[model samples]
Structure formats: structure tokens, C-alpha cells
Target: MRAFAALLDALAFAPSPAVQVRLMADYLKRAPDFDRGWALAMLAGGFDTACVRPAALHALAAERVDAEFLRLSLDFVGDPVETAALIWPESGTEPCPPPLAEVAPALSSISRQAAPGLLARWFDRSDLPVRRALAQLAAGRRVPGVTPRLARTALAAAFSADLGAIEEAWHGQAPPYGHLFAWLEGRAPHPEAVAGFRPLMPVCPLDETALASLDPACCRVERQWSGMRVQLVAESGLHRLYSGSGDDVSRLFPEIVAAMEGLAGVFDGVLMAACGPDGPPYRPAPPEALARRLGRKTVPRRLVAEVPVFVRLFDMLFDGGEDIRPLPLRERRARLEARIANRTRLDLSPVLAFEAAEAQDAPLVLKPADAPYLPVGPPWRVRKAPPKTVRALLLAARPGGTGERGPDYSVALLRDGAPVAVGDAPCRLESVERDRLDRWVRAHVTGRYGPVRAVEPALVLEVAFETVRPAPRRKAGLALTRPEIVRILWDLPADAADSVDALNAPVSRPPTAGRASRSLPSGSR
Candidate 1:
């Protein structure tokens, strides 16, 4: 338990990937096979059981602490493990929790009805470090910087070899793998490659301004769908659906699983739930609902019926016995067309015509008609974003040259033709933009709070932002992440600028199917 706690702690604060790999490898070498296998499984996010649900942990903690306090702590900290470790009652018993190898298996064998009592026993005997480690495991997984790819890298570091062979051997290997250990020590020959889920190639975002340089005839444009990108593998009489990040989400959508049982190959597609039976095809559900289902060990039947899932096939990665990734996208399109015709719940994603002459301002992706699939690099998108600029009325600015560094700014939008405060961020203005901001600040300064200066909300400025989120702290109830002052909109009057409702309305994540798809400029694909 001490060694496991130490590993989790070191990994949580690990400075770099190399250091993370080194720490994990050191522990793996020192711990016995039984203990190390469990640790590996936990770190790689494979050790999920109904025995330790977040609700179960909270229920047990509610017996000792106030329920409202627990909820508040969870909200403020934005982390479950930290909250549990801090708020759980101190135990008087000797710090002698059972071995994790025994504990995880014990928990798995018990019923959900018994989980609360079991969890209480764990919290009662263990210190915060032990509880934190167990809490992380119980709450599914966390980004300790050691992903499966990194885990494979750690294995590679142990034997001083490249990742190709190590990755090939790791496929389908189970935990407490004595065979892998034996092979590493040169007790056996290298393991043969097995057909398993490989990482899917993702579409690259295009460089928007470079469109005129693209050759129209060489590229094809398609509507980038709104769904979770996934890779489906049906090999050796078994099927697996790996999400883009390489996590096996096969069990999350069993309807899709049952649908693909008859097929065998590697497929690339998007997984959507509760979309279309006909009509407009598929209306992609909110990401939050999908996230809820993905995190559960066993999704409830009620939720499954409410949010039935389906896959929209885009490409075929394998055919018969050959790897089709090396073939051109155009070539694979025909294979996908023939293989997935009129399939139930799973159908071909439409390929939009390359409408080059339609609208020059629309975000367009000019993919080479002959582009071969590459998991990394070899970008296919020519430009993937629409116009990012939006009008905002300058409301405040913070002066520069402080020890905390320099200037900051905040802008507002009109609500019913009156100024309504939005969000603010550290000022990011070019030299020319800064000169203009200085004029506005000097002329409009009305009040000051330390470094922040409240200015007359008169000058209309053009601002850009990455995304928006609800802001309980702001009067406007919305704030932007990664906001930057792009340019001064002198031509657009302050009253005629974008309204608070317009800015606050769901902002589109261009190229993806964000909620405001129609109003927002389409991204180039």
C-alpha cells in the first residue's frame, strides 16, 4: 500500500513524461508481479468495477460529513479524489489497509449493495494518501500523464528497445502477464503481431488563409460530423470499439457492438446516440450525456433506452487480409461504399461535393483526393476555422508593468441596447492594437480598482475567443476562454455591435457540429 501510494503521488506531480516513465519503471522493477500488474492496470485505466462508484463513496462519506459540504467541496476543487482525501474522517485504527492486489479483487467480487460498507472500512483504516490512491482508482481514471502509449513507452525503456515490437506484443495481453515479463528477460522469443484496435487517424484542422493556394481538382471537401471519433476492430471472433484516445469503449454502446458482430475488420467512424431513425439522418446528442454513459462500469437500462447509440462509418481501414491505410482515401471510399451499404444503425457518412466556387469566406478543407491515411502528421485539412472575430465594447482595462506582468482587458456586449458586462482576461494586443487601447483607456477612464480601470463602454473592439462557458461569477452569466483583443472595430458603432445574447448564445466550435451550426460560419474541411 505504501509503495502504491508513493507511485500515485509521484505520478500526480510528475514534472515531465520522461520522469513519469522513469518513476513507473522503477516501481515496476521493485514490486512483485502480482502488485505491479494491479498498479499497471490502475494507471492505464483498465481497473473498473461497480464496487467503487462515486455515488457509493459519497454515500459512505455522508455518514460522517455534511452532504452539502461534500457537494460544495467537489464543486470548488473540481476533483473528487482531492475532496475525498481532505474531507474523509481521520481514522484511529492502525494504518494497515489490506494489500491492493487483494483489495481490488475483493471489491470486484462484492455486490453494489455492499460497496458502501466496504468503502467505509477502507476509509476508516487508511491515511489520506492511501484513501487518495484508492479514491482515484474507484473514480475510474485520471490523467497521471501515463497513458497506454506511455505505458508501452515505459516497457520499451525497461528493455532498451523501440516501441514497435513492444506495442505489438502488448495487444490482447492480460494483467499479471508472466509471458511478457519472461520475454523481456530473454526467456522467450518475441510475441507475434495480433489484429487488435489501433489508433485512428484524425482529420487535421486547415489553415484558413491559405485556401487560394490549394488546387481545387486535387482535393475533396466533406462535412465534418459531430460525434465521437472511434476505431472498430473485429478480429479473432471478438469485437472492440476503441475511442480516439485508445480507451476501449466497447461496452459503453453494446447496441453498436451487437451490430458489428458479423463484420470483421478495422473501421473508422463516428459514434452518436439518440440521433436519427430516418429524416435528417442523425441529430448528435449533447456531449455531456455521452460522457456520463462512457464513465459508467455498467450503464443503466433506462439510460440506454433513452440514449440509444449508433455509428456512422466513414472509412474502412482493413479489407480481407490487407492493410488499406497505405491506400489512398479515394480508393478506400469505394471499399467502404460496398461493405456498409444499407446497414442498420450503421451507415456511410456522406461525402459532400467539393464546392470550391460557392463561397470564398466559408471555412473549406481541401484534402488531396489521393491522401493516404497516416496516424500522425501528413495534415489533410487546408483551413478548418471560420472567421473568429466578433464585436465587443470595451468596458475595462488593467495597467501594465506590474510585477505580475503587464496589461489586461475586459469587454462587454449590449443587452437591449445597454452595456452588459461579460468576461475578462490578460490583455493580448499587438503593438498597433495596444496603441489604440491606450487611447481608449486614457479617454474613457472613469474609476480604478488597483490595477483594473473601469472605462466608458464606448469603443467597439473586435475580439476573438477559443470557447465559452457559463460564468456563475459574472453578471452576464458567460465567460470566454483564451480571449484576445484582435482589432479595433472603429467602423462598427458601439450600439450596433453584437448583443450580449448573441455573444452569450452557444458559441460554435467551427468544423465540429457545435450547437450554433447554422448561424456560425462553417469551418473549412
Candidate 2:
């Protein structure tokens, strides 16, 4: 238990990735069999204990703490687990808590109603930080900022084991991982690669200067959708869906799984929702709408009905169990187009002629015709996003921001009747509007985290930016560069706020700056 606590504290406080890895390696080297195994499970995101949820803990805390005070504490702490750990009344003089191996299994064995008491008892036995870490384990949440990839990386670093060998063997396995330990310690065979997601062939921002001079015939440009990049790995009458990050989302998206039934081979694509009962029109839902679908493992029926999903096939890495990654992308796409044409819930991502006019409306993924698919890193494909502007909502604001022009406001573009933050910028509310904003911030704020304050997203603002380029930093797998608030847009309705895709749509001529800068006082829009 102490070792597990130390690991969590190290992971939480360590700012340097190298230091974090060293700490993880240190813990793995000393901890007991199943205790260390459980720690690995937590690191690799292997637990989905049907016991207590973060909600239950929050609910339990609400019963004992002052509601307003708790809310304020949550705002300050930036997380619920830490908030709970700090505020939970310690049990009277209990000895040290049992190791995570024992505690976790006990939690998992009980009913949902019993989870609170057992977890509370465990909380009482430990100090604040251990309680916090245990709360996270109970809720099946990862420590903030650390990634599963880093966990795998740390394991490789510690054993001086092959990274690829570690990753390939790590998938679809649970902890108390004696096999992995044996294999690492040279006592057992190298674990076989499981049928799962492959690392992405990352793309870089296009060099617009080189774009014009490059020969079009050597490349194939494809429309990039504002959707989730997914890998479909099917085997033995079942299919699994994984996001680009390699998290198995088979249950979160059952529709996609059913669509891939009977299909064998590895395929890559973007997951999108239907544009109504229309033919061949798959598009991204508003960010919040997609969030609702993604936030649950067993998606509710109404949500499934609300957001029908389909995949726009991107590339074929395998066909009929034959490795086709050695083939040129154009050849792979041709084969993918032919093979997946009649499959349910599947469509080919359209291949476009190298035309300047239509590039902005979608991703122009330029792949060399004969280059073999290199399942990692950039400089493999050049992606371009033409200059554009979006009508976004001023959803929230933060105090004392870190960005040069920031710390004042964060903006969100609307999707499916919910606000989603597109980017943060320096506040640009008009002098008259700023006064009203102060009052609005007080009355309408629902929650907050650190410097960021959440407000009712009823305000509209016009944001001008150079491009909606691909960036790993942003939630939508894209970010706006040089975004400036041109207007407060008080006249525009929140629901009528412009779509994100509108920024990517083709424009016949450049928009005039002055005419488009129409502003309204903050009180209305």
C-alpha cells in the first residue's frame, strides 16, 4: 500500500517525463507480485470495476460536506478525487490500509450500494494523498497528465526490453501480469502480438510554400474529416474498435462493431455521424454531442439513435490476413475502396484531384504513391488547412493566463446544441460589454478549474484565424492559429452559431475585414 501510494505521489508531482518514468520503473522493481501487477493495471487503463463511480464518491461527499464549500473546493482543486480525499473524515485510528491488490478485489466483489462504505473505510485507514490515489483507483480514472503510452514506455525503459515487443504484448491483457514479468525477466517467451490498434502514421502541417511547387501526380490528396480516427481490428467472428490513442472502445460504439462483423483484416478510418437519412454523407457531430457518446462505455439507446455512426475508410494496412502495408498508399486505397464498398457502415474517404479550390473544405492528405505505410511519426504525409474564420461562442474565461495574449477568455464553437471550447484567447469584450460580463460571470458560472471559469455559453463572437490545422494539442485534433476576436456577435443566436466545418468550407473570394466586424453589446448575444 505504501509503495502504491509512493508511485501515485511520484506520478502526480513529477513534471519531467524522464523523472516520472524513473519513478515508475523504481516502483515496478520493488513492489510485491499482485500489488505491482494492480499498479500496472491502473497504469495501462485495464480496470473498469463495476463497483463505485466518481459520481458515487461525489454524492457521498455531498452528503457530509457543505455543498457550496465543496463546489468551491472542487473549483480550486481541479479534480474530484483530490477534493474527496482532502475532505473525507478519517476513520478513528485505523491501521495502515491493505495493499491495492487486496483492497481493489474487495471493492470489485461488492454491490454498488456497498461500495461507498467499503471505500469510505479504506479512505479512513490512509492519509489524504493515499485516499486521493485510492479514490482514483476506485473510480477507474488515470492520474491526470500521465498517459498509457508513457506507462508502456516506462516498462520498456526499466527492463531494457524491446519497446515494440512490450507494446504488442501489452494489448488485451490484464494485470497480476506474471507472463509479462516473466517475459521481461527472460524466464519466458516473447508474448505474441494481439489483434488490436496500430500506432498512427502521424501527419504534419503542410508547407504552403512547397505545396505550390510540388508535382501533383506524385501525391494523392484526401479530404480530412473532423471525426475520430479509428482502427478496426477483426478476428474470429468478432471486431474491436480502438481510437487513435489505442483505447479499446468496442463497447462505447457497438454500432461500429456490428458494422464490422464478419469482416477480417485491419483497416483505418475516421468515425463520423450521418448527415440525416442521406446517402454517403458522413460528418462529425458537434464536439459535445460526440462527447456524450464517448463518455460512456455502454451508450444509452437514445444517444445511439441520436448519433448514428459510420466509418470513412482511410487506408488498408491488412487485407485477407495478408500484410498490405508494404504496398503503396494509392494501391492500398484502391484495394480498400473495392473491398469495403459494400460493407455496412463503411465508405471510402474521397480521393480528390490536386485542385486548389476545394482543399479548405477537408483534409488534403498528400501521400507519396509508392511510399510504404510507415506506422509512426510525421514527414510521411503533408496536411494543409487553408486560412479561415469561425463564429465561436465566448464560453468561459480564466484569470492570470499563461499564454502571451491569453488568460482572459476561452472560446467554444457550438455543435449539437452544446458549447465546446475551440481555443482560448485574450478577452476582447467591448468596454461596454465588459461591464455586463462581470455581472454575468458572477450569476451564470456553473463551475471552474484553476484559472478557467465556466459560464453559460450564450455569447457569440466572431474569430478570425489563419487555418484550422491539425494539432495534437487540441481536443478536436485541430487548432486555430492567429485567432482574433473580430466581433462580439450579440445579434447571433447561440443555436445559430456557425458550424466548425464552416471554417473549412471553400470561399470564392476573401472576406472584407470591416464589414464582417459587426459587433453588438454583450448583454444580448
Candidate 3:
């Protein structure tokens, strides 16, 4: 009963079934003559409540927990709490469980009578699940001398408790699945909240200096690839693919859906922009183009053909058989590569061999063979800093039907003389209506025609133009003349000169009598 009471306190404060089973087992073990039957009943009932019956059942099947006790508990407990809990509706269910009124009275009566104090100690009981139900019941309504204690416990959970500590508790005492939700709701604060989500972890703003400071022998690097971040979750033959933002993308990528058939595990990786007839070199589609592909429910056959996506397998959080996140990155990579084997769609991510240096400049590019790899780094190369290009495009400026300045020109990115992603940026107008565009341009285009007015950031356009005529007054060198409208590229990563000296210390080479080579590349080059 002591074990049961403590469980009641724990469940009252933080409900988790994994704890109930383990606690019940502990009770049965410590008290050889304890109520084995009641413990089993609670285990079965509690596991049902927590929606973690499979894991619990597996443990029972394995005899890791006391099966005899759990069996007994299941037979003895006939409480309405167990009945209501058996059918706890999951998210998106049309109707909720029957109104609380029908069952609340029984729960309230039993709980108020069972425990007179707010935090009723149940350490003497073998089955904690029943006591937990009683606590939830007691806290639901005004119980004499009980409400204050329940509120105090809640406050402690909200403020005094450390989330990191609770997460550690999961390894030692709690269930794994609900930790994320519990942390988000503030029942616990998981420091590794971003750790399990593959795509988000890579994109997360981490300190570069800190990353560099880690033991070089163990640390590695890769280009931050440009593509959609996907978290693939599969359990019991059900598959769900979620974007970094948690938006479900199961249907958007049927190829991926088909690819992961019969697979079970939680993993993170990127879907790349497909390339080449025989799959030349895979690269991520520019963010803008990728967005178009991502927004669709059903992609056209032609579109998928034009822009096939492949997976860049990165970190494997789980394998076909085991949870392996606690393993270091190198180990995780090994398991990931071993479990997922489809060269056509899956490629292993390149590792950045760490070197001790004040600074390093490496282009974050991938080998053609490593296309469609997980956690894509930029294709050019992984370096402390990357190169930037400046281009001007000429575009036809027009007002949309809504009276807003439309896009300027479509944009394409060139890295090492090869076309990469396409970009689009539109002219902006404060008011979107046609008259509003005219009025805004008339007011702001201070020059002779003042033909184009700065508008809101919308309607991407393709623009073609020439050199940057430096203007001190303008933020970006304003395009002078209209030319063939190319794709619009705007707001590229804030530009920094790619001079080697800027990113790293210049290496001194012996001066020779030979003249230093110089050549004029094309204007666009």
C-alpha cells in the first residue's frame, strides 16, 4: 500500500503509466506477501489509460515487471475510472468521452472518501493506478482541506521543478513518448527538446564557436543543406511524415511513402531536389521552388518528374530494432547507414573531419555520389564562410489587378558555374489595389516617371539587368536598365566578400618571378 500511495502522489502530480507498472512491480517484489492480484489489475488498467499498453504488455511478456501481480490487479479492479480510461479518445476524434457528469460523481465520491487530505499518501497500496485515479478525482472538485494542497503541488510542478531533471527521470523512472508534450505544456522542461527532431536540430541556431570547441577528434561538420526538413515516424505499420513545423507531409511524397513501406523507426532527414537523367548529382531545390512542391496535396506526374526528391539520410534516432539516440553521432550514423539501404533515394551524409585551427574555409559542397543525403549542407562546400555573388536583372514592372506592384524577375543561383536553385522577388506596393499601386508609385517614385514604387514583399518576379552601380542613398544598388528578365533572387544570405583573407588567415607562398595570373570572367560570371 505504501508503494501504491506514493504512486498515487506521483500520478496525481504527473500522470504516466510507465511509472505505475514499474512502481507496482517494485511493490510486489518488496512485499512478497503483497496484493499481487491488485497490482496486476492496476497495471493493466493504468497501461490502458496511458496508451502505452504495448510497451507495458511487452514488459509483462518479458517478465521484466511482475505478470502475476498485473494479472491479479486487472481482475479485481472494476472501478468506473478503469472503464472510462479504457476508451480515452485520441486527438481528432469526432466526439469526446461521455460527459464528465455521468462519471464525475462516482470518481468524486470515491476519491473524497478514500483520502481526506489533499495529498493522500498511498505508499501502503500495491496498485498505484487506482490511487492515481482517486487523486485526479479528488482534485477535480472542491474537497475540504484538499484543494490547497493540490494547487500547491501544481505550482511546484510549474515553477520549482527542473525540466531537465524530469527528462533524466524518464531514463530512470518515466515513459519516453509523452516527454515532448509534457515539456511543451511546462510539466517538465526538456533541454533536449530539439534533439530528437532531426531537421529542426540541424537548422536550429547553434553557436558555431561552441561546436568548434568540442573535441575535434569526435566533432564533425557538414554543409547546411537547403531543403525541406522531414521527420519520418512509423509504428505498427502506420507511417507519418512531418515537416519541421510539424505539418504532416505523408501524402505529398508518395515516393517516400512507398520507400519507407514496412519500416519502423523515428528518423530525420531531408528530401532533395532531384537531378540528372541517370541521377547526375542531387541538390536541394531552391527554397522558393521547394515551397511550391511542398504546398501541393497531390503533385502532378510531370512536376515530380521535373523535380524528383531523394532522401539524404542523416541521423538515425531509432533502428529497425533498437532506440539508439543515446549513442554518439558516429555510432548513430553507422546504424542509420546500415538500416536504410536504397542508393537511388537514400544517400549517407558527408562528415566534416574536424581540424584544430583558428579558422577554416571549406566550400560546403557534396560529391555527386552523396546526393540526396540526409541533413544536407549547402552544395558548394562546408566552410566557416561561403562565397556570395552579385547579379542584376532587367524586369518588366507592372501592377497586379489588386493594384500592387508585382514581382521583378525570376532568380536562379549559380555556384561554381552550375545552376542551382531559382528565386523570385516581386515589387512591392503598400496598397494592393490597382489605383493604390498608381497612387503609391506616383507619391514615392520621386524620379521623372517614378515608374516603380517599393511595395510589400509579395509577388515574386523574374528580372534581368546589369552591373551594380553603387548608390550611397539606396540600400541595394538599384537596377538601371531593363533587360531579359531572369529569375528573381532577393535577400540572399546577407552578403560578405568571399575573399580568403576575410574568412581565414592568408597563406604566404614564396614569391616567384612569374607574373600573377589574372583573367576577366563574363559580366554574369
Clashes per model (N, Cα, C within 3 A): 10, 2, 60
Question: TM-score of the candidate numbered 3?
Answer: 0.39
lDDT (tens digit, per residue) of candidate 2 on 358-455: 44644477777777777553345555444355777777777641222324677877666667666765545454556565676778787877556788
Give the Cα lDDT of each candidate. Answer: 0.68, 0.71, 0.40
**221: Cα error in model 3, Å:** 1.4
* Superior candidate under lDDT, 1 versus 2: 2
After the best TM-score superposition of candidate 2, give how far the Cα of residue 63 lies from its true spot, in angstroms: 11
Which candidate leads the pack in TM-score?
A: 2
Residue 76 of model 2 has an lDDT of 86
Compute the lDDT for candidate 3: 0.40
lDDT of 3 by residue, 264-382 (tens): 77777777666543432355444344555775658887876776777676666667547665566666776777777654655666665544232444334222222233333423222
Clashing pairs in 2: 224-363, 401-407
Error of 3 at 333 (Å): 0.7
